[model samples]
Target: MAVSVTLPALGESVTEGTVTRWLKAEGERVEADEPLLEVSTDKVDTEIPAPAAGVLASIKVAEDETVEVGAELAIIDDGSGAPAAESAPAQAEAPAEAPAAQPEPAAAPAQEAPAQEAPKQEAPAAPAGGAQGSGASTGSTGASGTDVLLPALGESVTEGTVTRWLKEVGEEVAEDEPLLEVSTDKVDTEIPAPTAGTLLEILVGEDETAEVGAKLAVIGQKGAAPAQAEAPAAPAPAQEAPKQEAPKQEAPKQEAPAPAPAPQAPTTPAPQAVTTPAPDPVPAAPAPAPAAAPVTPAPAAGEADAAYVTPLVRKLAQENGVNLATVKGTGVGGRIRKQDVIAAAEAAKQQQAAPAAAAAPAASGTKAPAIEASPLRGQTVKMPRMRKVIGDNMMKALHGQAQLTSVVEVDITKIMRMRNKAKDAFAQREGVKLSPMPFFVKAAVQALKAHPVVNARINEDEGTITYFDTENIGIAVDAEKGLMTPVIKGAGDLNIAGIARKTAELAGKVRTNKISPDDMSGATFTISNTGSRGALFDTVIVPPNQVGILGIGATVKRPVVVDHPELGETIAVRHMTYLALSYDHRLVDGADAARYLTTVKQILEAGEFETEIGL
Candidate 1:
């Protein structure tokens, strides 16, 4: 008996998965519960196990092909199986019986020439039947469907990765509605459907890369069933019926030509040529069907060029203002390596230099300064689009506004002492670890409440200054992909414990790549803790649409003069840190920034969270 192996449901929401790799090929024996193949879904990648101990008879799904849940993936045949065993022998016997049948005609050498020539003339008809059948089936779906192409994501972005698919095969989608999410090096956006129709097929799966304007999927009229599988299966049996009759017809034709073998000697080798190529074309005919999409061929040259430009090289080119298309690549297969981008930037710099400056370097016999390649330079990968977007936003903030940084030394001895005393109790009660960051955020929110100027934004288009009622503070988190700022909405309303929980939740999401766009927007002020990375202080750039960003620095024990109630001004060892505020001077003046920082400094020094933390 042949056991059908169907794709098991991997998740409740996951309707389909792509076959990434097959561990066991057809005809390979497998043990029960053994690993069979690797299936990749948008949520996870896992291996499907063999259902029973048997020979792997056939694989219905090919690698890179996606199939829905409960669809037959492959068949495992035990020794008792008849159909699988019968079909195997039939195909195997056809080629083997050809040689065996030749001996009968060879017994009389006189008739052998004509007999062999008959089969040669008839062999082509079988292949033609098979070829036509496969062609018709493959073209059926394409004829009525509209190809959903990968549209232009952004300027200079030649390709994008399909991060997810919103619609599956057999699902209906509306025009201009988001069907999938594409992530380029510069943007992460949704690609919408061109027309309202049923999604017939998906040429590209999640996490797969496709060039711009390439066919991503196919959409047909609503209520039209997918004939991709049925059409091909229906034609295979019809084509084979004619193929079986070809050999029988050739036998009779050969019987009529019972003549001398001398004249037919030249035609004897003709059968070998016909039989050899007959099998080759049948399999090769269907190979070009997938490539039939007209969008594929025209972008061949562009794919070759853009395919090699990895995200690392793209970012480097953008940072240096070097055009990637113009630079000649020297890496393997003309890949745009990091070194290539660096060299191009140097060349552009030299071109921009004065004539005297260029000549002086040549006269001095000194070579241009070369950047040392890091060990990580050789590795190429598609970086997340968020990184490029972050860089672009930083540049825009610097150029689009009058930005400046102001630094103030803060004595946080009381805050640190208060945290040390209340951390264990706070974690036990709130179920979140007590970190100095939450305290800083609490103080920053409080200061923003007092001095709303730092927490305000200027709308140049409207020519107005808008002061937000609530402090939607954006916490800058260093995620693996890039810098992410997940906002803590209504931070002014949240206490120390609430702030701690929200910060931890947002950071967790950032690290896990689960943070959504909704979590990143609507921020009136942003805070960046450079101190976590051991930095003393940094002039963090203000994000776009925001007027100010507060930079927290590392705290260290230092001797500082302080006034006490009993003792006069005296130098004592205390924990101190620096706070730098980067604000757009257009909306926030020097005095306003100073006042905000001063208020935060006073809050931290006061350590008024004793009751809030149950200290």
Candidate 2:
């Protein structure tokens, strides 16, 4: 029966999402719980998984298409797919399979005993065999190996870039040990080894990105022997062939230009490349390629690269020996159109111009630089994958929406006095420091619940508004690595002390890089303590999905007006701070923002939390 798949409700107030990209295409086999496609919401970009194991029969909604909750995205042919419609029982039981899309912890614990025993039993046998085969196998062993993969980083994270590898090929890795470090857009984390074994191969090198669940390295039995002449290692070398072929094509073209200006013997590095000893090991291998023919082409090759050309263009260009760059481009963006290359070949045939055959020969002898010039500056520095992702998201949010910020002066004299009075006692009781940020958080969350517009989401095309029932406030923490916002799931439910403890716990997780995907999601409102570093005020940008972000400035003692019965108004010293709220202009107007801030200001000034503070 072909089962229809629809987008599930992501989080509070999130009603629709854009299909970011498809991981599994039509005709591809997908296992139960396997990621099918990634969907982007204002708050997250998460992979939607297959409901059951089956063939992906068709994609109903293409990539980048926006669809509302419950809108069909694809059809899965699970062998039981119905002809016209699913039976009544099937329709009723559809929700039963929803658990398959997420990992079930209860089921995992039930299966752990068997899993633990299997690895323990194999541990001794693996060591016994590995001792005998380590030196002889030379990475040729293929009998028993476990593939290590990049683990899922977060709900919105789809891929991660490997920053470094701690273990090298031939090194022994213990189960549950740190294997490599990976940097995602949200966090930087060390991926641990799944089982104890010898590191057989490093498939994905440093700085390379591998999608979630993509194989990164192969770990083999400690002394596993190579299967006799099976040559499974051939796949690795074969993969390198296509990558190597590109450089072969670019070599002459790059050198041709350099030499035409002033050819240097040292500049043309290709001749020395042909005689290089690197091909010896590949030619001696039993599988992979017809090694001799590929090696011989290095010297005699003309007009490099079969890429970016049709078979006809390749044939015609090869016959007349025309340089593709020399051929005038008349296609889009002045590209060397296929017809233009063919025409150049015909022109060469008639003119007998001989072309730059001499330059091609010498340039073929040249070699590409031993190391490529850095794509960035001369340092070859790469942005941590997570930082790059954050940057991309910031750009998208800034450009995609109408955003505005309003500033308000707030008097937090009473809240500051309460904090000063209870700091030592509160820290002793809760085992965590009490900070003014928690007061602001509690105040903001309280204000959000009162003025729901600040905690609402708007879908302009749908012409609807969704106001959250709970204040799942996101507190932006400045961790050492980056800015991390781990939500205080129900901030409105927590008192000042409770909010303080929760804030401490969440911030600790971010600092330790232990914050889970679930901890980061479900934020209906956001708050930033810009005052922590003594900033008077700041206009903080609201994160996508959330309607507003409250930026609280540093509190300082200042002279202010105080009303008295007989004195009318008198100058008095009080702790004062500035508050800035950046909200989505589509749903929240300036008056709404002012009203929300006013509510927060009133709450803090009221200081009716002496009981919650245990003061």
Candidate 3:
């Protein structure tokens, strides 16, 4: 039997991917779960795995071809049977012309039964590719009534560019959660749910554009809701109303106009009345207005040429502090292009150098020599996709929302003690090195649960705020490409040991670039640990579409005052670390953010369990 391999959806907002390379060639035997091909999307480049142990029979799509999710890319045939000769004409026809044709009929009957069953087995493999194809198999036609439209993401946005579609038709979607990612000119943002229901249909494709009032998708209640019937048509209004009111209002206006002409006849009886209007006309007064315009036209061309110069030359002139008006244009019709402006600028630079060259020696000898100046030099580096996305998001977050940061001192002595005692045994049992991050992750989850707003994101439009019920915590991992935060889903349900195990596994996958795109998504909150670098404290920039991020610093020992319930304050030795919580002030205020950080600190200091216990 041959198993068809299809492309997997990489990210929530990624619809199509280009094949980067094929790891295994056709006719090579591959083990299940081994890497088979590399696929590249805008968000990430990932290696896909083989689905079953088989020999790669054929590769359908070539490298560099962009294919949508669920498109077949390759086929693998298991060692149990050979493919039917009749089904493949090229392989069968060539051999039939050879001397071995006589023995083929005796073997034909034995292979005929298996060929009939091949189509039956191939049907089950189709559902694993995507929800759109699978949902159709179950006969789900989607919901009815009150069309749920795609959401408007921001104020200035009249439409959104659909980056990717997260849910397919008949897939269940939660209320006030991320439905899709929409990109506007200002920022790329996630559109949240207005209500909970199953998605009925996807009205748009990935990279397809849609207007604000237009329907991009629909959501409705699950199961069989009653179909709303069309409303009855309304009767036409009577035609007699307009004719009654037009004649009465026109009679009074007509009578007033007759008396006005009689008053004009009396003015004609006085001869001086006709002479009074004659002096009002003066045609020669307007001739001087045209004479005043020549003064304005003389400088217009020079000013326009200066104002419309190339920005590159303008910047070059500003950095050297040179005026652009003195530079002449050699471009088409005397318009300034970069090369023309640059050539003129070079001449001006040399002219100014003559005076500076004459004055440098005298100034150097007359006074203590000016500090030796180093030339301003640096190389321009291209940013990775992750870094560019991160930079754009940070700028958007700072500009669009009011951001507030709060710091709290946490005593991590108990956490350190716990890790120190169990690090070896835990590593031996789990085959992974356990770190202090899992404990911090647990503490963050606890803090998020106690204060749900920290796990929420602000929907600037519709005047609504959304909070997530699931606790998927994103751990900031530094990779070769850039910084990526792969999420650990349902972190609140995992114990400390489970958190340690999963964090170690995910970190290894991230460093090696083996993490699936789905593993990096649905992150409700984030935690960035800069403590490994020995930095005492640092500010962390917030990732776009997330509400908050907790920054953890290095642990250090210091003498501090302790307050006891029965015994007053006393000086004691304790281990402390600085915790910085940067949150979107649009959703959370200073007081709530402060309280959340304080709660996290309290959970770590009041460690009320054994060293190697459950969460």
Candidate 4:
């Protein structure tokens, strides 16, 4: 028996989840309670464990596909992977076995199997038997109803918003006919009826969401009174319908192999091929039944590329003002590659430069065309989903807090020299580039310990200020989707190298759009590296609850008045940076802000990382 793996209810509000990645591939042995795949909801990202110990026989859903609660994600073969194959010799022993199993439809409930078996059951008064069989087939076809489900739309798409109903309830529909339109985060597509029948019971309403395999509508006999009738044993029929459709699929799939192995392949792979198509239907829907949308020869890689462009790619395009739509893809089936995005950015720069060069007019200085600004010059475009969420949060944070900033400059020459010396060794050991951010994090952690007021949150309801003991620092990343802050949990406990490694890991996830919601939470303090973009300093907003946010500005080599103990007040070239602290003025006083910033500045300038850096 195969056990089903389904999307469990994560929370009352989390109705759906996206399958981000499968840790265990199909056919891989999975232990009970072991992580099988990573599921991402709007609120959090977590690993879904295997319900039972078994071989993951089949993966019904692919990575990045979304599914709702109770939606079957995969089939685990619990030591029952080869019952049919094992009993094959016995099945082959009895020529009458196929016919014997024909009436198993009585027990099976799929009367459609009788129609498939009828051709082999040609024993009786030919005309009389034919007439009876014909009548039975017609009656079954008419009465046997199908429950139309919200099929797997795309990878990582759990539920679909029903945009419109193409056919209303009580409407007659042909098999594979358009029924309703559904929109997901990545794609918008119209769904089709499973079979030719009367449209009854539109279970999922327009503009509402239904998970994969959730009832969308019901199709019954022609002219049958359309009622809100739930199809009998919907889950059973759902699993079997694909099996019935699998054989009816195109010949191209097996055409080449069938000819060469018509006789030699009676024992092994052929039977598995026939049997495997049952599970295979989930990925590649048969003939007019497309799992995502219209079944095309187009590669799913291309589909994935079109739908889920990584946040980094989107951000790169955004920063460079490159139109992703205009960029041509060089990947499979014209899938947009990261390189393609980069090329487009470069092309955009060249195009803008060409116009400026043309306008320069080769020293003759022909005046550029007086570009008149149109009334609709800046077209009003809807914000991206991530951007909207970010905007809302920023506004909410601003409205809720009385924020103010304090700045201080620090000499990080020692830290820069240390990185320059040990970067290669550190990268080799930690597999992450040694950067100044980790040193800043170390300084912040050390400072937060000394001045816990800046690392604390206010509870107005309780009228209490809670100062956190452990420093969980959130490093604000300008992600492709929006601004994301991936936290370095227990930053105070981790050494400089540990912080560096964790920083790289968290930052990689953000840049790749794989950073889960949990990874973005639990920050007692925050750091914004504005200097990476060459800014001297920025007034970074403190996150809600957290009292302060430290902005680390660019580390630049500049001439500074150095107050040397030995050579008093000498001018020296050093790597200097400005640190800005944005704090909640209501909770943290000006003195508290000054103390934390000054402490962090002192720690960095004091240069106590020799032991950690193996200097």
Candidate 5:
């Protein structure tokens, strides 16, 4: 029995994904949980893992194919002896149409003979071996019955505009053949076929925008008749050899005049006239050709309308001072399109028949050369989904709560010395590199215990500030997707080593995109370590649900005067850093905010807690 592998939902908003690549081929033995394919959604690129250990029996879709959540991507046969002959007809018919329409050349004749022969012997038993023999082949068949859906290209991308189709229906496409191009806010990418097959149908057209998970196209097994009456029209034009052959003689009559004038204008007109007659003679000589001439012109006119027109054409026409109205639309139904204008303009240029030059504007009429603006200038990018959510929450925090910022300078000489001395041993024993962040987190947690107001969130509507008894510090980590805060739960209870381990683990998960949504929520306070990158200080934004966020600056050695009760005042070299505490003013007063920061500084500078905290 084969286990069908369905596309997994990557995120809450990600209902579909484009198969970027197949890491392993069909029929290859794979281990459970092994990465089998790479998929790209708007939020991130993720690897889909094989569900169970088995031979990769069939891959239903090819790389670059977009598929919806729950769509079968591949099937795994768990070393079961082939299924009985009863299933052969169903399996044989599954992908018949898609494979036949693909653009790539069909699989070698020899490889397919056995499968074809076995299906004749008995339908049930043959399907199992057939399913395992060539997964790509079987997948092409399977795809015909399924709809390949469009994937969201990014978190900000709710839908994509189909830019162009690279393959026509009935083209034999390879597993990873580029089927179409799509454009989203973040990128323009070519979507590939999910499995090798004949393209059976195009559900969307160029320039049409479809929501994520919308069906784009259908693929069917090679040589399979289309399930619909309109199937013959879906395949590539070349596949209709007999149908197209008749039109070949007629096409030149239509294409000749469009291309001739452009090429001839630069040369002698006599040569243009000579070449024009040659194309006419060929079409006129063929009897079947003339029959198609009248019938074919209408569709050709329609196709000309659908062919792509770029902005460059419009710009060129404007620049060259060509009147698009006068130029004929050679494109599908006499629409004044870009290519038609360009071709017309180029032909005019070649003929040296420049239109009467417009009178040059008076020197005063130039009106101070107009400045062209940059494309990016004045453009507003819509905030990404994550950033939008973060922005909304931050505004709520600021508007609902009184926000205050406190700055403090801390002497870290003794702490730095201790860290330098124990860094190697700590890293080796704990399997986590020691960093100043853990010290800051620990100090902040201790300070919060002493001043719980700094750790409380305020509810303006309820007219209350809620203080948390336990210290849960949320550390901000910048990821490619956006900013994420993972909490170190019970930070006050853990020593520096424990803090380091937890921080490292969380950071790793953030990079791997495995951090659960819950991991990012429910924090009492947040920390931003801009200091690691040499930032001296920065006012951190208060997270929506949190009371405060601590910004740690770079540590530097500086001279300071020290006065002690037992010793005379003296100048001492101290490792110092600037700290900025941004707190919800509604929950924390300016004095309390300052005092909390001062206490955190004292804890770090004292150097006595180093021993107690087991740093």
Candidate 6:
């Protein structure tokens, strides 16, 4: 019996999803509830677990292909025919085609070998051994090798680029070993080899984009000869006298490509390739060729030295006008990192300064050196999928709602004092650093409970407004990929310490690319801490489905007029920051926005959190 794997309902609004990648390939065994494939929708990217423990028989959908909800994704065959089903499909197809298409070569080799048998007995034996290896493999278990397809990286990621290949062709790899490095929109990770074997071929090269589930490479049976030899053997059957010398001649051609193969090169069919007609001292000479031929072009393109460059590190290098190839990496495995690029850039600037100073008098009257142009000024690379998604969402949100921003200045001198006094104790008790962000979140949630209209959303299709009772506040975290807002559910119910812990946890997840779709959805409101990066308040745009967003600005000590106890008005230095509240005008009027800001301002100014912070 075969079990059908269907795409289950992911969310209420997600009616369809794209099959991003298949974790288990056809004829691969999978346990029940194990991840089978990854499905991506507009809202989230998630994996679909196997419904039953069996051998995957067929895949109805391929990578980057979309299907509606409830569509059958694949079929799993029970133990009744798993072994036969696994090997038989590959053997059946290869044998049926091999015998039919290769009949001419097979016949030609048979006829020519008999006439030259006396002079080339040993030559005939070598070819026979080579032929039998392939023949026996096909007759029994086929050595067609396992296809290494790309796995799903994360939610909403449909495709990935091959950043680097860790193992070259003909290299023996252990099962679950890191075979290559892949970079998707959401994360950069290693794609491990599914089974231990010799790397046979590379289908996708460096910098090439492949959809999830696309075959990236092939892994052949252990100690299998290079597939290149098999190709030349087809044509060698036509030769009359030189039939015995074909394998020896082909051996030299393999050596030309890879001169310095790894020491472990002997493991990859060196015994089989030792069919030298002369007293050939080096049978393993051709071993390196099979592995290095395809990978040789990769280094020539200048990416070999900087194989593990991350997007953040690359962008940093470009912005600083530093050549990545020249920078000595200090990161793990000698990978280039942001600090390495910055250090290289600083060194280059120091070197250029003296030369510029020497020529300063000659160009004394020239205007101060203009800002240097960015290295990416003339380059027009493809926009990342995450950036495109963010742009589209922002544009849709802006067009869908009537939005405006209201700004207010609040004196947070008292709140600052409270945090400074309690931070040490807070960290000791909570096991997490307490930041000013939780205070802002706490105040915003309190205001939302009082002025629900500011937190309410207008449903255009239904022509209704929903004022949520529980405040699920989304904290905007600046991640390497883009701006991600992971929501803290029931924000109104959590105390200041709880809010601090949840915020820290979510922000960590976002930065590390571990945040799931569920952690990002169902926010009744949003808060953007532009102040963290020193912004003086911003008119932050509201995300889709949310009516409002609050922006926090940098706090500074400034002189201000204050009421003195008996002496009347006086000037004092106080901590002051600005807050900008952008809301949908259709649901929240200017008065409502003002009321919400006032409530938040009063909460911060009062500094009434002694009990919550255990101060």
Which segments of candidate 2 are over 4 A away from where they belong? 1-381
291 in model 4: Cα distance from truth in Å? 4.5
Supply the TM-score for candidate 5: 0.45
Top model number, TM-score = 6
Q: Which is the better candidate, 3 or 5, if ranked by lDDT? A: 5
In candidate 2, what are the lDDT values of residues 11-80, reduced to their tens digit? Answer: 6656787887798777655656667888766544577888876678899999768899899999998885
Cα lDDT of model 6 by residue, 1-615, tens digit: 899999887764567878877877886666566578877665556788777777899999998788999999999987675655444533543434423322333232223212211212222222222232221110111125786877766544555667678987667899999998876545568999999988766656565555555556768885554453453453233222223222222221112222233222222221221223321334333332231122322222345455546555667888888888788876444566556787899898878877876766874676465377887888999775456567877999999999999999999998889999999999999988888889989999999999999888888889998888889998998888788788899999999999999999999887766777778778889999999888888999998888999999998899999998987999999999999999988888899999999999999988899999998
What does candidate 5's lDDT look like per residue over 61-126, in tens digits? Answer: 997688889999998886562332223432454445323322322221212222322223322221
Please, what is the TM-score per model? 0.44, 0.44, 0.44, 0.52, 0.45, 0.57
Give every collision pair in model 3: none
Model 5 / residue 485 / CA error / Å: 0.9
Better of 3 and 6 by lDDT: 6
Stretches of model 4 off by over 4 angstroms after superposition: 1-287, 291-296, 300-377
Could you give me the TM-score of model 6 versus the true structure?
A: 0.57
Clashes of 1: 1
**What lDDT score goes with residue 173 in model 6?**
94
Candidate with top lDDT is: 6
How much lDDT does candidate 5 score?
0.61
Please provide, for model 1 over 1-615, each residue's C-alpha lDDT reduced to its tens digit, 9 standing for 90 to 100.
Answer: 889899988753467877878877787656566567877654335567778767788999998788999999999996665334333533453434544543343322222222322433453222222222211111113224787877654323456666678887667899999998876554467899999988766656554456555556768885454343343443333333322122121332133333333222211121101122222312232122232222322322244446435555676889999988888876433455567788999898777666647567455776665455777777887643445456767898899989999999999898889999999989899999998998899999999988888888888999998998999999999876577788999999999989999999999877655555467667889999999988999989998889999999999998999998889899999999999999999888899988888889988988888998888
Give candidate 5 regions above 4 Å deviation: 1-383, 564-567, 609-615
Residue 87, candidate 3: C-alpha displacement in angstroms: 22
User: Clashes in each model (backbone N, CA, C under 3 Å)?
Assistant: 1, 17, 0, 10, 59, 2
Question: CA lDDT of each candidate?
Answer: 0.67, 0.63, 0.60, 0.63, 0.61, 0.68
- Please write out the lDDT profile of model 3 over residues 1-615, one tens digit for every residue: 889899988888577877878877876656565567877764567767778767788999898788999999999886553344213432443434323322332222223222222323332221211123222111112234233444444322334445566776666788877887765433356777667887754544444344444345557775522211110010010011102111111111112222222322211111101212211222232122221112222222234445333334456667656666665655323444445555766777678677766876664666543354456446566554456556765798688767777889988888788777777877787777777787788888988998999999777777788888989998888877777788899999998888888888888777655677787878889999988788887778777778899999998899998896778898878888999999888788899999999989888888754644532
TM-score of 1: 0.44
Q: Which stretches of candidate 3 lie over 4 Å from their true place?
A: 1-8, 15-43, 47-382, 460-463, 564-568, 611-615
